[model samples]
Target: MPVSLVILAAGQGTRMNSDLPKVLHQVAAAPLLHHAMQAGLSLDPEKLVVVTGHGAEAVAKAARAYDARCDTVMQAEQLGTGHAVAQAMPLLAGMAGDCFVLYGDTPFIRPETLEAMLAARARHAVVVLGFEARDPGRYGRLIAEGEALQRIVEFKDATDEERAITLCNSGVICADTAVLADLVSAIGNSNAAGEYYLTDIVEIARKRGLSAGVVICDEAETLGVNTRAQLAEAEAAFQARARAEALDNGVTLTAPETVFFALDTHVGRDAIIGPNVIFGPGVTIESGAEILAFCHLTGCHVSRGATVGPFARLRPGAELAEDVHVGNFVEIKNAILDEGVKVGHLTYLGDADVGEHTNIGAGTVTCNYDGVNKHRTKIGKRAFIGSDTMLVAPVTVGDGAMTGSGSVITENVPAEAVALGRAKQVTKPGLAPKLFDMYKAAKAKRQKDQA
Candidate 1:
């Protein structure tokens, strides 16, 4: 059956004590909404809707940024979960297939868990995701007989026997689109909290003789972020899982705990990541590439056999081809280094392209920006850039060209040519001794006069 996703992101998360929407807060260098959307995307749902309320604009922007096809609807009021899901009904009007309700603050729901919920739909009309919480702790209780769920009772409304049930509702549910709409519309806010509870759907479904089922998942998979401490815990959990997955996929981490990965970071098998290496979004390290300790990389690609710094930064648009060596203290931004290019210590290459086999000496810089605008520097194959050479922007060094150390290259150099743009040296004999004696005598005279 076709599937649709309705993600709830309208919670103000007042417990978080921040102006930023709870869904916009990041774990693993990505917004929590992204993680939720990523899990939903795995289902390839035909329609995706995000119900927004608190900080709706910001939440909508983040949702669209992660998936442009995502549709966002505003709840307008801080109603209950049932009201939140009701807001998405208009978007799903006449849409066939099942609708899976997800929570934005819950980022750890596994794709497999959702698949299990879908499998349960074959036997029941309503399926609710549940977990055996280590401590039920005020969570809604799922009254069930084996896999057959009878009803859900909020901790506040639950009787002593119901409260004793260890099975807790995760607030995630799956049902046919039309059935969900009807049940949500029939819901009333006459409970203890006077709020429409999505959990009521289970009892209502059972009243109509439609089967209600429960799909149990790990307790960790239902971890929800509500405050700063929980956010920190979520980050730690994400990192632990990412590290374990990398190890299982044949990537080598010299210090696994010291390495952090972003949501979209991809390191191929055989890639070696050293300690304290932080990866930001949009990074890909091909197989056999080595990223040394203390390196920060974002929006870059490192091809096979490339080795990056023990203390280097690769900014957005940086691309290192096969066998490229970018050594310590080097920073590359918006540049591409072809195969066999060596850019050793203390260099900054930005908005430039270096051809194959080029040797960039220490302290070399591509002066790409001129206060107002940015320009590009192009260095051809086999070119030699001497130490301390500054290639001013809008310049090119042809193939096999060599520049003298301390050169300020503002113009192009032809192939096979040696360019030297420095002031000629002129020496004056005995000038240093004479100047020193004059200065010392003057100093003595001044001291005597002062005395």
Candidate 2:
């Protein structure tokens, strides 16, 4: 059977205390809502609908970034879960397959858990994701009869015994599209909150003689971020899972807890990651690559056997070929370092192409931008860039060419040529003491004048 997904992102999240929408806040270097969307993408749903309310435009934009095929609906009012989901009804109208409802604020949901819910739909009309919470507290209780879920009772409305139930509703529900639409339509605002609750659909299904089921998942999978503190907690949880996964996949992490990974970071087996490394979006480390401590990489690829710094930054468009060495305090952006290239510490290589086996010395810089225009620098194979050399943009260093130390190169250097851009050396002998005596006489005359 085909499946679709409806993501609810209509909450105000006033507790977050920021102008940005709550769902837009990042966990593991990605928007929380994006994480939810990624989990759903694994299922290859036919239709993905994101319902936005607070910060509607921004939230919708973020949603589309993850899945361009995503359709968005607006919930103009902050009513309740049922009302929020109903906003997507028009899009779900003609579909008869299973439709899963996910929360944008709850981003740790796993694909396997969603698959379990969809699987249970084969035997039940409604399937609700639940968790055995250590402290159920105010969460809605999931009343189950064997594998069948009898009802969902909110804590405030439940009796003492019901409230004690540890199997709590995680607010993730899946049902046939038509059944979900019908059940949500029938839910009324008759409770103390005067809001239509999606949980009511469970009892409504039971009343219609439709069997309901529950798929139990980890409580951590249902964590919702409503404040800064919760966001931090979510980030920590995401890191723990990502680190463990990296280790399980045969990658090495020197200090697992200190490293952070983005949503799309990919590290092949045998890659080594040091402590305090942060991977932003679109980073890939091939097998045998070593990334040292305190490095940050984003939108870059480290090829096999490449080594990156203890304090390097790889910005967007940076690519390191096999055996490339990018030392500490180096930053590479919009550049490609070919195989066997060695770039030592304290250098900036941007908008440049460095050929194979090129050795770039410390304090070297490719002046790529001038006022408004950005230019490129090409360093041919085996080229040597001396320390403190500034290779002005639109310049090229041919194969086997070398530049003198502290040289300011504004033009090309031919193949195998040595480019010396510094001024002629000159010295004045026996002048230091004479200059000091003159300075002392002047100082003495000035002091007498002042007295």
Model number with the top TM-score: 1
lDDT of 2 at 184: 96
Q: What are the per-residue Cα lDDT tens digits for candidate 1 across 51-70?
A: 99989999999999999999
TM-score of each: 0.96, 0.96
Task: Tell me, by lDDT, which candidate is best.
Answer: 1
Which residue pairs show backbone clashes in model 2?
none
Q: Model 2 off-target regions past 4 Å?
A: 433-451
